[model samples]
Target chain A: MYVQEPIAILDSGVGGLTVVKEVMRQLPREKIIYFGDTARAPYGPRPAEEVHRFTSEIVHYLIQYRPKMLVIACNTATAVALEDIRSCVSIPVVGVIHPGARAANGRTQTGIIGVIGTEGTIRSGAYEQALKQLSSSNEVISLACPRFVPLVEKGNFRSEETYETVRESLESLKQRQLDTLILGCTHYPFLADTISEVMGKGITLISSADETAREISTILYDRNRMASNNELPVHHFFCSGEPGMFKSIAQQWLGEQIDLTPVVWQVPNIV
Target chain B: MYVQEPIAILDSGVGGLTVVKEVMRQLPREKIIYFGDTARAPYGPRPAEEVHRFTSEIVHYLIQYRPKMLVIACNTATAVALEDIRSCVSIPVVGVIHPGARAANGRTQTGIIGVIGTEGTIRSGAYEQALKQLSSSNEVISLACPRFVPLVEKGNFRSEETYETVRESLESLKQRQLDTLILGCTHYPFLADTISEVMGKGITLISSADETAREISTILYDRNRMASNNELPVHHFFCSGEPGMFKSIAQQWLGEQIDLTPVVWQVPNIV
Candidate 1:
């Protein structure tokens, strides 16, 4: 029997933990290696070249684990550097964007789709192209929610002013009469209640994390990447920043504590 | 007189652009330096240390451009690294968490508030702490909507399935019987419609982006960071990923056209 290798997941920071959560829920038997570049995060605002350099370095770092597959849990890195990372690593590199686009395409009624994401993902037009390529008749309206991830990370999910902000940001899109909306960034799912409230009853909200998780399952199944049932799968986490903060947050998000270790990466030389 | 300097707005990615749009609408005279780290994107799932590092990098990068004031448009970065970045930089740093928490605390009639966000932010208890700190009588129930960011980023803002996702994710929070919900993540604003539908109109939704913008304006005015009437405020965008992709989606989100430029940074050495 072939020995099952772990799945390697990388993000600029802890945002990718959402992806890890889904992976754990859906594929509990598979081991995981999660790497967060805590020392340098919020990859959305940097230059593409810098993002690419950062993504490559992280992927290179994760490669040492020799996981069976790779998940780029970050939308920005997926948008700017997924292809580059794929080329650099021998493992299959899966990103959240394509799976998300595919999921959105699968479920549109009026064909008018709305997307919200970080400045990088929305600006990349990767989803637009993917949706357009998938179906020409579909109309995709994208909004760059540059603050959403930050807001979510800050723990301001339910606030009166947050609703007003939602109203203001989405007022135009609501007017567009879109039937479906995509949560382009991984961090957005946390605001599902507020988003649903603003968009009204009829509009649909699609989560890229769910779609990406489903896609990962499908891909792994097709590639026979499932782990053997000989022992419990080991999930390991490494952050470029403080291990204590990462561990605390990871426990809360995952609802169960896992081992989180700190690994410093030489950011200066990687770029 | 000092030359007019642009307003600097930064997020992990596109979510902060929502704040930029608001700032533009509320104050058209201001030039804006909007940076979306399309490269690293979505700080929601990463560790606090990494989020802090990424936040500092962007803040430092934005400072190089000499903006009048800085708006930390992301809640996650604001919660984890705002103070650190503020200390490192000379310019005034504005984060969305406190203003948003204040807004929620002020609007709750039942004194029962529900806060949701990415795992890291929710775990940090920033909003909950801020809300409770403001009013001990208020009860805050915090949950992490891990899937929302990716869904919004992928452009699936409203759909029947998305509604189902919203319903499933928020089922527990709804049981808490809270009157106010904070759109903790800037991206949650995009999902406001669906969320409102699930929670009903009786529940008020708040967004940190709008509140943060107000706070930013107030700070700019208080600190005399407001730009002078000189030349048309130049709006510049820098992405760590693809400029073309960023521009197209940005146009959709901002409801206008923007010129996005790509920059490359050495990632390996920095982190």
Candidate 2:
């Protein structure tokens, strides 16, 4: 409950760095402890039970830090594990799905919204359910872009190949006449530019990453647990696979803020 | 905590209808009980204690409705009475200020944000405090547009005089180079078109009324208290002065939604 306690965030792979970047920018004073199960890489094609267990394992690992809040930054994990983790946790637990859903519902002028996510996220229909829970009249068109996670996992962001892949993946969605599109996967923000280009200027892209970070601020402030630290906070990063690519993407995504503070790194075992 | 119970919303005047409209759009199933202190409109120039008293009186009048939650849909009243009301209420009480501030902080690329509200809200420094709480580096430029609320109460949303008044009032803020402008007052959303025209597309306007509705959805869903009523529930309206002006403004602001449901109206005595 201490204000100085970090907000723990967990994702299947480096894809969750999108949420990390937003948290760093939106809540600068609050320290963070993150876990990226990069050894498992993409959880998109995995079974629900396995994703749930992996999330729980990461939660158990991060709980040792005694974070003020838990952010389930991966949409796949959030679709299955948010309630399970919330039941066990004493502090507030936020998921990527609901925040993005709420933001999209609020911003969407036309109730005909489009959602793009990994196979796991879209199949789970988490975004649709979340959106419907807010407003019943929302007409949701959901598509599973299974190719997206691997592109981000390998750090392939914004290339001719990437653009073509993104363009083809979004081919069907472009014709839906949707005014708002929810990037249902946290990894999607890394490819936001390519997606934006494919979707064109008429559609607004709602990043679950940015919205989740904003929700973290709202929940923390509501609970009176916001950090009052005046200085820049040093954040801790943990990954299950090779640290090289993870560190590079982490640094590139986070930019100057991570440069200001030396990161504490750890590579936990795949449970 | 029955989900079917209404959400009690109170404001200094008709400005809160903006929030009512958003709530209807965002959380349609939930019933609403609104109170507008029209007899003592323009709380901006009043003392904090008097504003607090008027807010408490309306809250008391609305509390008899046995609502599930309370929404302080007035920036001036929220500045002076939010915590006071929260301490005395059993259900969740939401104020208008922080939601707008959070949205602005999350969306601002340059850390410089502008806020426009009633005199009481600006004088209370609630927006700056809320913004700074999320990110310490934010440079907040705030202005109290004392002229804005009266125009809204009188239902003067758009006109040449209104545009001229808005332009002249915002002349100083135009030079600040702010990337985000928070319509910190709930009433400002009524004049959002004029405000946007004056501020230009360079600055994004954050409407507290819309953000507050979004926040209400978030909190209710988080608490597992969302209303499941498939039918549009009827809403109740109360005012301290003549019902003619208040009802007309409410209908015009709420439009088709209020037309679908028969509203129960009351004019409560000023305490």
Candidate 3:
């Protein structure tokens, strides 16, 4: 019965919508204020400090709305900026890595797990460390599916090119005999069916989007900050790049008509 | 890498073992320091303020060890005291409700969900509110199986009386046509088989303990607070009440020999 404030969710591009979809599925009544820094496109290839700066800047834009929570929906951004953003705001903030790692631990019976993400997420070894911390006995295999985000951004999840790239990237993991594979990158869930096909039905694919949405639900409930059930929710969308393409893809994925507002970045001087 | 510090976990009674069991399974290298306030067992019926005080006192006691994080493993304690404890400490603090709600949200498809918990949890309407916030369209039915807790405390989860109590309490929920049920109380997972039998295979059950453990894994990973993998983890257990019963039940549930430490509660003066 608390006041309903919009939750601000940001990602480098469309990858975070996988998270937004899950959040909407899990928390329908709560309004969402989403910003996709599509102008920056892929944060994966960018330096950690650059990702942090972009994340911080987007967060500053989001703060104007006074959101109740902030979700760093992009995996690369999350790896570099999650803690920094938590320090930036008093409201609850969450990212994707921990959720994916936790779900992978739960699903794997073979004690063998695999993680696939961008170069940064894989290179950072965040998933490997998290999996190891959870159970040192777990055999964690990580591979950077660097081609994945771009494929998803293009909305080519099931294309033949995607299949070849996915199969080639995951070919190494199949040899490891992993029973569970984590789509460490948020965008990867959009590629789940193809990934599942390549890995086969025997291997469980863990989506950070699903787990992150659940984590958000948990924190909101713990803080006595759940939105009231009385009103209909209005969701706001923004992207720094071409609104037409972003809107088209978002509508295709969301299965609804949406108004995507364009946001121009005002780079703030950092001390 | 951060220095390996014990992760502090607290519950009203032995129920937290479910979470500890998970933490141990997921994070094998991390040491655990567990405290079951068996002397002040069953936080379900207590007032929020009183529960908060007791939780704060226990947290103060646990903080002496300089734990790397705090896990509020009990649902009642978590619902009332999680945020306060987070405010009281600098180490990352986590709780059970959001995790439970998130898991249930993920599991439920019919939009009709059921929550069974202590009177305090049900009366607080935390689960119902959380579910609704996730999706206002969700029809959430909550029931207080107050009798279920005492049965669990006595380790009578599979007995006929426990079945009868579970059946009687959940009979109303069955009539509501729910596709998923959340074992909102940490003690309730112990009653899972009986509860499942009563609800039948049609409804999936969500365990707060499992979800909470996953959340803990997520937080530790995000902070880079993961314990080193090379060292063997040493787990310590404590109780303010009778250690014998607590130890026996814990050993049976964990399927491992554990050393149970007894601590005398020095009631701190609270303003």
Candidate 4:
């Protein structure tokens, strides 16, 4: 049955909304199924096995909807679970990491790329590896910003203390004299000002979400997954937690109303 | 057993690292179990129920480690899940929304507050409600910039397009003529420049994360949760997704080495 299948977008929390927004913008006619596992967020600190399992569960839940494609909007999940999910699912699985890395690699003029993300993401060296694999000339300098996420989460974007933290965090990267800085973590983009203030106008900051969106566009186009109709798409959201809060936030972030449903997933046995 | 209890810090993604960094700096002797659900991130867009569920799951997962307290570093997650988590867990649950709202309420001269966040977050009206609850004088004008998260996620902090998106998103808010702009979504902080550039120099941007961190410090101090006794606090990272990617980004964002371990959780049945 050639039904109009929805594209599944999953995140640890609302971070994946960035991707959903893009899908709406780029593929306005397609149906979207978004899932935010907000309960166990900040997946960067967890073990790889756990990440994979969590990702698998989410994917399994999403697949029940029979999505045409899956977009792993979370960077931590993309880094660790994308491959696993891809292997497990029959639908095409896409992630944000590679697209961001590729975008950073393309934008760097001096080949000195600076990456900022959660401790787990930074420690993984995914960007560094991607940069290296993409090109030998690009030098990746990564810094783990354990506080940036919290700062942004708390909405401390322009506080003096936030600036101080950004200053302290970027001191080493500033010393490195890099031209491009990759906002490796989806949340790091919220700290752009503190980072830009610290890094100055000479350096460029790249957001992984944007790159990932563009990548999704490419992947969909390549696979003929783009919606054929020109009508506005129906974006469905499922939260394992709270529907009202999710609707409110999704509306705010996407600048549109999204019908959100609650899905009960069977928690698999954890070893 | 006199064993050091781990404090759990959770966010949608890497942004919580900012809080983690502060905890590390302020409570050097304490142990932090930082979880970034990079797999499903940017909780700013999902439904409240999902965010609550995700937050609850993460809290439950973290509680297994027997953390002394929990920090909801992501503003959206905090806005949706804080009270629920607090009710469910014995540990003190701290969220960024109240602190940021309080700060903005205090700083607004015209009693008109402008909030920017991911579509889901802004739509939740959590900040608006919080600001109003704190003081009736505070009139909140919220705008959802769905693109901001992706821009920040893709590390397009200083890109021309990013600036343009910020300008477009703020155009409606500018009409409100508010003196204070609340960086409602944790991800919006990355677009401060674009926001500032468009909003001009007179406007003040409040970050929820910074205020939340400050609040956390205060709470810890008051509750004696702060680390002491000349012992250095150790921060441990857990990711529900990719450890390598999480670690790489952590190194870049937190400016330190984070050992990320995966914790697999059963996706609890959501009804």
Candidate 5:
């Protein structure tokens, strides 16, 4: 188990950059290899079988990199593919669901939790299962905010339109007596500030991206695979669609936080 | 391999009940077996060799129950004995230091962290090593408060005396520009309210007990050993000291949180 092997991360679109930014910030020494299936921007409305197939293709492609770990940064893919990927891969495979659920379980005093995700993720009931698996008594309320993902993918973070959109989408969730809310979708972290403003100060928003980065650190340390690079390590990024929009969004989102090398493959969805 | 096997946790004294409360709250279905070395309390002042030996003895005794996981809830003991226990045991062995360090690394925006623990833990520099292992740029400030453990073991949580002692012990540390302060010792969580009052709200207190419990859930999930018992499992507790004080403190600290059966072993230190 070489420690210098980069951790591989894959997502359906630029939303996974939320996880990338967090991993870079929390674990500065570890190298990363990221893949964004920009040709397949939103996997939320897709069928489960198609999402699973797309996820498997990406994992097989990224396997060539010999990553020490594989992280399914997209909640939709994770809902359908995390266990399948883990069964096929030898390295540790982590998803965004459990970490966010674990954080919600740990943080919520009232045991009433709210989860917001894409339609595919909500339909999968993965968050409810993950939360209840830890403790049987957690009352889970789930919502699928399909509108929020488009705003994040377009990098439209904060404005009057965005605020109203966020507030309207979270209309019913905020009325519930929940002490903790899990941002089950990786894209949701980009809209956290506006979401928090709409939800008020009482509800704590648990970001799976941030928690997943922390878990990556935990699993790496547990397996004795943590990197010891004294100098800053360079990260690699790849995309399947137009690098122009991907790179523009990536640069605007990551900015100076990432020391990265972009490699646009222009690879379409695998048949 | 049975999912019902208890998780064994040990601390120098009643300080570990903080971890117990969290584990019970977070993963309530899992059974617990607790050991408190109250007779030889305050592993803080002891030599590293003695602390290591004491920890080994408790672990050896707990081995009879065949716990699925072993948690060194005491920071001083964890610093001196975690790797040794991990090497000797087949089950997963967790320490309080690294989880707290990881949480601090994930939470801090300023790259500055503060750690407060017993003399033994502070001298061992476990938190510093754990914190820097993830990110080298983190500036760590550590302080040892020997007076804090005795107060918690004696069931003194909040009072003018407790508040004054906590304030005085953290006098210098509260002045730093740290965005996060790790409760590096298990006993420190008992004094968290006082410590937070003294340190003010800006400096987030990263409780090792809380983070350690959360990590325990993560590792169990990762290993596919999470308990699935629908019934509320009865928990067992043992302390190598007088039953009166131990039971009283535990009862007061745990209150209604624990569903417990206490068994005072009255076993003195091994030769």
Candidate 6:
């Protein structure tokens, strides 16, 4: 089938906009359907079982749209729910961790890589496991920057409060003399300036957003499922939380105005 | 299903060893079953319909082993047969072009990229289309280096003859001032030293082998099909043609001993 179905992407909040920006850049001809579970914003502190349930709920809802593929743009959700969602859906599903690990592996000069993400993602050890799987000799250090996400959600990214929080949170990692660091959380890129400022120019930062988009393109092209050239692509955005905030952040990052709808979770269909 | 199946990879000739080397490095725990169509080597010069038929036949034969996924490690086969084979098989299939295009897109600073591959791959215009889809403004220059494959296949990569061939093939691209070049064929990386020398230090080379390996890692990890740690990986190699040269190249490139089995093609099963 020459499927022209929209590609679906989801995250815990606006953090996934990082990935959305890349998808727009890499696959401009393909339409996208994005959902941000901003109402329950931080999946980081939630239990793995609860996170899985919430993510599966979103996936089930997205299935109604008949998306060609699924992208778990949130790191915590990806760590907890990627496989569960993949099994539930026939279409291809992608997560951020492997792409992040691959990028860090390619970028690192000293064989020492550092990753910073939410408490749940860091504790999950997904990045560490992936990096180690790629190269056993790679020394991986993971830290949880619990405060970074809230700072981004509140649009306090460039504020003095955000800078101080980044400085204090990354104090330990700063001493590691690492050559590469992964912004493991999808939302972390918003605070990149502060993070880069504190880490110095020497430490290369790897964002899985770009890598994930490339993987998406690869899957689409190889399947001959890429969108036809005659039609224009339309993007749909939805958020479980306040639409205004999500719209503002998304527009700023994407450099285009987006119409966002506030969507409440409906009863998930039992499969 | 908790799939423990090995990933099956194929190429028209020993050229696909470049991809196999990267897969082994990136996913050390996953077993790989590889088939080299050495008897019908150089799918590049063959007609598209013939290449598709040959690739589908190899894929059908490999499917008997019940592989979890497939990787079309040859550029020509991917250009001609990836979609057809994907539809014929149930498992996920990956190809080299999109990954290579994505890499070149990411690496190019001048928005001008160059691609070198077999005549078939270059003539297919897949890289140009992909690059343009990523960015309509990107300037794409594609060249077919038909002689490079023969040089690698004969184990004459570093010889002066190979250097002169690269210098001559790349003369137009060198003058184009490209900041990035996609080594569009899998066989080309074996001759990377000579190609790089010809292209000069300004052009960054993108090897689809590494990118394809990363995509495989992403697909396997997302599907929860990653191998268990309890089992040690065993590599299996097959060649439709002479095994001696394939074995020599495989061992030298992978820096490990490989046992290559010679297999003659049986009548293909009609799907």
Kindly list the per-residue Cα lDDT of model 3 for residues A95-199, writing each as its tens digit: 898778778887688998988899988888888876776677788888888888888888887877988998898887888788888889888888888889988
Residue A150 of candidate 4: its Cα lDDT? 61
Give the per-residue lDDT of model 2 (tens digit) for A91-195: 889999999998999999989899999898999988888888778889999999998888888889988989999999999888887899999999999999989
TM-score of each: 0.49, 0.94, 0.80, 0.48, 0.95, 0.86
Model 2: pairs clashing at backbone N, Cα or C within 3 Å: none
Score candidate 1 by DockQ: 0.01
Ranking by TM-score: 5, 2, 6, 3, 1, 4
Q: How far is B96's C-alpha from truth in model 6 (Å)?
A: 2.1
**Best by DockQ, which number?**
5
If the candidates were sorted by their lDDT against the true structure, best first, what order would they fall in? 5, 2, 6, 3, 1, 4
Please tell me which model should have the higher DockQ, number 4 or number 5.
Answer: 5
Across residues A101-196, which tens digit of lDDT does each residue of candidate 1 receive?
655655575778899888888778888976664455678998987767666655566798678777788777888878889988777776778999
Task: Give one digit per residue, the lDDT tens place, for model 6 in B85-182.
Answer: 77777788988987888888766768889999999998888889778876786899899999888888887778778888989988888778778999
Worst 10 residues of 2 chain A by lDDT: A256-265
Q: Where does candidate 6 stray beyond 4 Å?
A: A46-66, A89-91, A105-111, A130-138, A159-164, A177-179, A200-203, A221-225, A263-271, B53-57, B60-64, B106-111, B130-138, B222-224, B240-242, B263-271
In candidate 3, residue A146 scores what lDDT? 84
Query: In model 6 chain A, which range of ten residues has the least summed lDDT?
Result: A262-271
Off by over 4 Å in 4: A1-3, A154-161, A242-245, A268-271, B1-271
DockQ, per model, reads 0.01, 0.73, 0.45, 0.01, 0.85, 0.34
lDDT by residue (tens digit), candidate 2, B184-229:
9889999999999999989999999999998888777667688997
Tens-place lDDT digits, model 6, residues A126-206 = 999889876777899999999999888887779888888999999999889789999999998888888999999999988
State the iRMSD of every prediction, in order shown.
21.3, 1.0, 2.8, 20.7, 0.7, 2.5
Q: How many residue pairs clash per model?
A: 143, 0, 8, 156, 0, 0
Q: What is the lDDT of residue B46 in candidate 1?
A: 88
- lDDT tens digits, residues B159-242, model 4? 778878778877877777798888876666556667788998889888765555555544453243555444455678887765
List per-prediction Cα lDDT, in the order shown: 0.75, 0.86, 0.84, 0.71, 0.89, 0.85
Candidate 5 ranges beyond 4 A from true positions:
A257-271, B256-271
Candidate closer to the true structure by DockQ (higher is better), 1 or 3: 3
Q: Is candidate 3 or candidate 6 better by TM-score?
A: 6
- For residues A47-66, write the lDDT of model 5, one tens digit per residue: 99999988898898889999
Error of 5 at A203 (Å): 1.3
| Reference interface contacts recovered per candidate | 0.00, 0.70, 0.77, 0.00, 0.83, 0.38
